[model samples]
Target chain A: MNMKKEKQSGCGRSEDLVTYLYGEATPVESSDFERHLKACAECRDELTAFQSVRGTLRQWEMETVPPRIDIAIKPTFWQTVKELFAMTPVWGKLAFGGVGALALLALFNVSVTVGGGGVTFSAGWRPQPVQVVTPGTVPPVVNPVTPVTVRTTDEAAVRAIVAQLVRESEKRQAEQLDAKLVSLTSKLDNRQRAEFVKAVSQLKQDQRLHLASLIQENSRRGGPDLLDLIGQVQSASVEVEE
Target chain B: MQTLETTDMQLVEQTLGGEPDAFGVLVRRWERPIYSLAYRMIGSDEDARDVCQETFISAFRNLKSFRGESKFSSWLYRIAINCCHSRQRKQPQPDVSIDEQIEEYGLEPMDSRESVDDRLYRDQRAQLVRRALAALPHDMRQVIVMKEYEGLKFHEIAEVLGIPVSTVKTRLYTGLTYMRKRLEHVSDSL
Candidate 1:
């Protein structure tokens, strides 16, 4: 239709066509354009074509049911924490890391005293002097120059403790020996029962072989021993079934 | 206050104020339009979905830069446009062109209808329109899709694209003329 007028004498109204078509133009602009529309068949035709295109455009629509779009939004706290690390400056991260490490060290410094022993630590804990427990049989050394960390052992206490430990060891060894003897006896009983079953099975097998041999030999010899051989075979078959 | 009826600005404020689900609320509000925009712009469902996802992520990342100067949706549309542009540059075309898609899906019925022929006719028209839209230049295509399909106003489209409203009108008009010619030609051929 624009070819019909060949650009409407360079009407310079092309841009307004979309605005007017979309009803975005003001009423004054609409009235003026309406005057122009009455005279310009080119604009009218083009506008008509555009309006039809808009109708045709409706054919390509978004799915009636809106599609599910996945855009991750983590939990508030998690996002904050993530952004805290991500958005933080290097110096800020370093400062935070330093404080975190120190706080962790201080928290770990809390020690529980067990049996007067220092908790195992390498950083700031000092080793305390532990009193030596021993039997007091010998006289204490009188070395004035010795360090305070060293203390004399009680020989009598040491002897009594050693004797008690020896007696406990002997009792424990006796208990272990009793347990071992019971286990061995149980194993021996099982083996003996198994051997008895094996011997009985062997005897049955030998009896069956002897009966079959008797049947074969009697059949060759005569009919007199036939009843005895038959009796023996029946007894062997009964034993096998049993 | 942060219900479904909350304004986009309020939700943006909540999101910026460290309310994470508020951003989720925003995503739910705008993802469909953004997807539609990207889909029409790039003509690929998968890439359009990708563009939709990246648009929100970039918006969330750059929420501070939003500054409330324009509408939050304008800001979101701006991100979506940038994503679609970069995506288009990276791929230069859809994963499958309109012809390939038509060949594959056979203009399947878009919705439940009374008769098969009506559905078929409607779907063919849609397919022709999609091919026309996809064949248009990117600048004209974005303007037309934003205006006709997504229903963004002229000023809103201008704001999102960082262009003047008159340019949007001209591009939209030219784009529609091209589509009219293309659709006519295709129908004549058929």
Candidate 2:
């Protein structure tokens, strides 16, 4: 028991001396530790030995930097979609093929309507019969004359008239689309324009909201108050009128 | 635009706010001490680098859960120590040859005659020290490495290992006593 007590006391002294050597002791503790070390050769020698070991360990420095790591970034919607599509199996592509066929059929119906063709559509796979207008619904004839029955000549003339009508309708539709695109493009800044293109291509609702929020945030940060925005809009209106 | 004095907490907040590059500054600052701790604990440069990288990756992934209760460096050191322990548990014991151990101790046939005997004595002492260190249990070896090589305080080590301070001190004392006996044997051999 006495030997155990002596060993405990010696261990405590050694720990104190180690702390003191590392400059972690208080002033009073340092004084007591120094007094103990001055009398105890064993503690003093142990401290020196540990210090040498520490010095040698310090020599083993890592000569190279750790390897580089890739950081995770928030991927854009299109980027995620591309990744998903790339990993999609052949069966998935076939399922998408069915959806594409339905979409194409819908697009053809809309195009036929816009072109004012005599074609009628149904939900069936085959084309339905076209509708003909009643003779009473036609405009009244101003003059009574014998209708010319030039078979080949009349077919060529009808084809020419149909082609001209289709071209005019297409020109009108193109002009309207161009105007809408121009207006939308003019309202957006460069960054917003890029975001808008990305949102449309990716078909993501969140991206659209994000683009809108970014525009509002930029306008707020531009130091433009409500009065300034109104003034700018009013000036733009006046310039358009001029 | 804020010119406030940057603290680790602030850097951590910035990193949590999606500024990943901000954490790179922390990595650059603490990589050396963390690498040193790992290297001393595992005694392999390659594994130490792996530990450092793994530590940073884990710290980054879990930064939001830090809770600001402890110093960032202390948290990082704890992660590194845990990584080292897990690695030690997974790796099979290395087959260390006696000749390689002697060579690591700088013991070999000497060419010069004047200081040959003294060189042999020093080599034997080094070999004894290495053997004693290897003989220690993993826990005891870890405590010794942190205390001696990494210079962590007893309380800090306890915090890192989640053990009591007394346990840390006991392990250190036990490890050193073992080394002292081995050194005495080396002296007898000389």
What DockQ, on C-alphas, does every prediction get? 0.23, 0.07
lDDT string, candidate 1, B103-159, tens digits: 764534343354367656666667768877776678888888888888889999999
lDDT of 2 by residue, A120-238 (tens): 32343443433332345884343337432322223334555677988999999999999999887787656565654553455345544544555587687885543344344445545
Where does the lowest 10-residue lDDT sum fall in candidate 2 chain A? A1-10
- Model 2 lDDT per residue over B1-190, tens place: 9796678899999877656668888887778888878876776779988898889888988898898887788799989988988998898555454344545654332333534686454544444454555555667777777877677887888887888876776666555554443343343333
- What lDDT score is found at residue B65 in candidate 2? 88
lDDT, candidate 2, at A20 = 69
TM-score for chain A in each prediction: 0.30, 0.27
lDDT score of residue B28 within candidate 1: 87
Report residue A170 deviation for candidate 2 (angstroms).
46
Candidate 2 TM-score versus the reference: 0.48
lDDT of 1 by residue, A1-242 (tens): 22111122146798777779999999999998999999989888888877877877887866444467666666666666877798999999999999998887766553333221223223333434434444565645655696444212233344555777899999999999999999999998887667645544554566657756776777788754444554556676677789
TM-scores, each model vs. reference: 0.55, 0.48
Which stretches in model 2 have alpha-carbon errors above 4 Å? A1-14, A38-45, A55-242, B1-5, B94-135, B180-190
